[model samples]
Target chain A: MTPDDPKDPAGQHETVPGTSPGASPQGGVVPDSRGEFTPVRTDTPVADPGLPAHQWRPTDVDPKLEKRAERQVAGMFVAAQVFVVLFVVSYFVFDIGGDGDAILGLGASTVTLGLCLGIALLLIGVGIIQWARKLMGDHEISEMRHPARSSDEDRTATLEALRVGTEESGIARRPLIRNTLLGSVGLLGVPAVVLLRDLGPTPGEVATEQPYEGAGLANTVWADGMRVVRDVIGTPIRAADLEIGDLVNATAAALYETNEEGELVLEGTERLIANSKAPVIVVRMEPDEIEDVDGRENWTVDGIIAYSKICTHVGCPISLYERTTHHVLCPCHQSTFDLADGANVVFGPAARALPQLALAVDDEGYLVAQSDFDEPVGPSFWERG
Target chain B: MRLLNRTAGRLSRHRRRPVAGLLVLLLGLFATGTFYAAFAPAQAETTASDAAQVEEGRELFLIGCAFCHGTNGEGVLTESGTQYGPALAGVGAAAVDFQVGTGRMPLVQPGQQAPRKPVIYSQDEIDALGAFVASLGPGPAVPEESEYSVEGLSAEEQEEAVVRGGEIFRTNCTACHNFDGAGGAMPRGGYAPSLKGVEPKYIYEALLTGPQSMPTFSNGNLTPEDKADVIAYLQESEEQPTYGGFGLGSMGPVAEGLFAWVVGIGGLVGFAIWIAAHSTRSLKQKGTTE
Candidate 1:
């Protein structure tokens, strides 16, 4: 029936076999004859499937069992509430400090918080489950399935429906779905144990490989006797050649080629990796103008010297040179390096100096490294301390 | 005719009488004036002494500078000083020339740092200026040029030179001039000039003559062409331009950020208020219609 028809409050229409309106069902409520009328049903019948033979819970059939079940459920809830109180006490009692009475090396505060909260939540979960099995209603019922989509009233009606459905489903009497759902959710703790694998890699796996040995956080491919060459060109430099105020961008010679034995020296990704780590800037001042840093008297050849071009703040490639001041500036953050004074950080965000590459002339008069940088190059990393 | 002859005879007699008297009076006045003009032996002796001093100056030069400046006081190419010093040849008898001549020889060092010092020679030695350097090859003498003379500069020339000078200044001097000519720091505690109130000659000398830590811009290194360009830039363009906004020294990003925060963002906020007011009016109108 149309909502406009006042007489048909249920909004259901009834029609004669051949006519469009004015129809009624036998023994149902009939509307007026004015053509804006229809029939409505007040009591809808429920189809029934007969109940199975009674197999009652021990609590339901015997009064002694019922009293015991009530005590058992209450006991679980009381135990859960006690654990919650213990959780609060542990938060204040733990002193995580240098004494190191930590659980599993975690601070006392961390261990206590995790354990107390975990046990508190677990006991409460167990209490609620015990309550349902021992004390909640138990019965069997049959219901007809309704359409999946619900009316606006169904939103408000869902609680009642769930209650009725629970009675029919016999979740309380069966105990299987109830106990297993509770137990499965509770046992989720076991996988947390399994996930502790991510805490650190196992001792002797990829970490034990020799390719990464000796090289730690603070070292690179730079080393003694390594020839300094033009970065991409790979031609070695003789100190006598650079004019005053000249700046040359160079890299370690090892980045360019391998030894004759056909062994992959500077192999695969190593050359690409070493190229980044070994970048250097060589500047020439007048021989008399060079200021010698203490203990680095021989670091320069005549007046030519090399320094790591990587800025110590964030490892930006730096090449801006003010020849007159002997200050090499990083364009990225303006970190100024004093090339004459051991490439010390004179200004800007850099925490440390651009590390100087000690230079010595080989027998052939080509510039070679006396040794690798005394300290690490590039942005400071954690182990730098 | 008879009367004329008689008058001539009378006039001749009168002439003889008056001429002799007039001649004696004239001679007496002449003697007094000459005696007054030429005084006693003491005055004569002072005059004679001055001439002697000048002669002595001539002699001193013969002994000292004549070997290089010739016997007639001309400069000698083969002289000891010639190997090092330029021919003083025609630097006139000026105070500056005199300062240079007396054992100043080759300067203790070149460049702008040269300072004025005492002459090692006597006054007689300095007085020889006319006979010594002047007697050498004749040429345009050192003029008493003014210390400040950019006045003769044409506006167009000043503008062009200043622009060109700025370029050269950036390439060569900005490292020291600091882009704004504020004079940035230099290596080993040296520094460049402030370019403020610096004299033209000092700049010329600093360039032609390398001073202290500044490298020499000899004709060989920076051609006169380059020096002129630098001078033009330094003299004319140094004053801040009167643009409609703050210059902030033409230091790029720092000034731009200051401008944005002070002007651009401020304008945006002001516009936003105006727009908000307009929007409120429109919203009120729409509400009334609704």
Candidate 2:
């Protein structure tokens, strides 16, 4: 550290007890004026424990034993080779998948290939380890560690060399060039930071700008009258079909948009985005059991109540329902919501209740969303206000 | 004997009627009734056997289950109102079949959960128990084997069902049952049991019954076809070997990651210690003072 640099915590040895002033090799560890080496520590907190006496291995003293060990290690290496051959042979001999019978629930080929290759590698590793342990030149060698810091003379010489180079280059005298070079080098990192913007659009940008109306963080494509369909199969849920204690993972039918050719119009990323926000789990309980949320009296058709599947805690899709208790648990963190009581958080870390999607039945008797969620779904953010 | 008595009583009542008329009517009725009853003894035997089975089931229940379940399967409650055994009134054939078939009922002792134990009841006894419960009220009936099997589906359709079932399983079953149906933890001390090697009929009944903490995937929620698909997938999946590595308990990444980190890293750490501290032969210590 430069003595003139105020920011640097220079002369730290003066404050720290373990590292006294002269103990620092950076200032060059020198002898006191008495012409004798000054002890680095006169009062040792603990005495240095010397190395214990080493024991001799049987293979080290006995020639016959050493020969036997050498043969044993060689045998392992030979066995490794045999397994390697077996692996190669098994490749051609065994039928994969459905053709041959399974062994212990594993395919014939998988079992043989895996066992052979695995044993070969295991043998090689063990052989090398045994050879190292038993037959190699084994001695307890103490390596004296050198001081980590460079010599004071070397440090001074390096500083001097750097000073001379910089002076010759006129960098210190030419502040204009030096500052601009620093500025340009620092600016070079900006592109890397700026490139991260392409990870996705800003959260609400899709809602404000995307062609699909209200499809983003603040809104979903689940508009009024959109049929609630099964998550993967995309079959619309008929209200009559759902019985008491039944839980169905569902989403808006808008997610299954198609073109004339029967290809999904909402393909890839667009569908994923819309579907993520609109995941709904429709569950039916006895109508008498429901404790209606204020102003949401008509939200349920019969006993069928639909709510967003996304957890209020961190947005993991939750549908581990216990129909008897009317409790739904989130697997990620045990946040439980009482579906009978307006989807309120009865336990765990969820700060807000699960957002409910009001539902209606269409003329075709399919369950449909009355509207998008009144409150924003999922984990809270700073800008949620 | 009862039928003969009823016929004799009817004859006495019609004693004042014309003799020919009474004789002709009695002959026609007796011949048709007797012939049908003899040939179709099957129909009459079913009703008789059902009543007999229910009676036998009731006797078994009184001996084994009544201590907790009460005399008529009308649940017994501990003083605090916590259910000792929930009422079996509407639980029906499916619930009784799943609980008894899995050997979860007739609990050795009460606990937070009923783990799968050695099934004490024979198949006939279990069916009798199921029939007894079914007589109590209308609820889900025990599923037939055809409902939960791939017997009717074509090979191509079976493959399609497996794919569909995988998706459904991930959405519905994976949270508690785990990704590979190896089972995982529940809210308190309860756990979802592994679906591995479980009979297809039991799986179907379990879905219908909502055994323990498992939610009901009723025929309505997961249609009969969906249930069949799930069973087909589970059966097929159990037969297939793990490709990547050890199943590692199949609790998804948590167990697998813990295993790798603890075993792999811990092994390396122990190896490092071994390398540092061990040597086969002794040092001479000639000029090793430094």
Leading candidate by DockQ:
2
Model 1 lDDT tens row, B203-248: 6545543333444344433445556667767766555442223346
lDDT of 2 at B30: 100
Measured over all alpha carbons after superposition, the RMSD of each candidate to the real structure, in angstroms, is 33.2, 9.2
Q: Considering only chain A, what is the TM-score of each predicted structure?
A: 0.47, 0.76
Interface RMSD per candidate: 27.2, 5.7
Error (Å) of candidate 1 at residue A358 is: 2.1
Worst 10 residues of 2 chain B by lDDT: B281-290
Classify candidate 1 by CAPRI docking class: incorrect
**Native-to-model Cα distance after best TM-score fit, residue B185 in candidate 1, in Å:** 12
How does residue B245 of candidate 2 score in lDDT? 48
Clash numbers, per candidate: 3, 0
**Which pairs in model 2 have colliding backbones?**
none
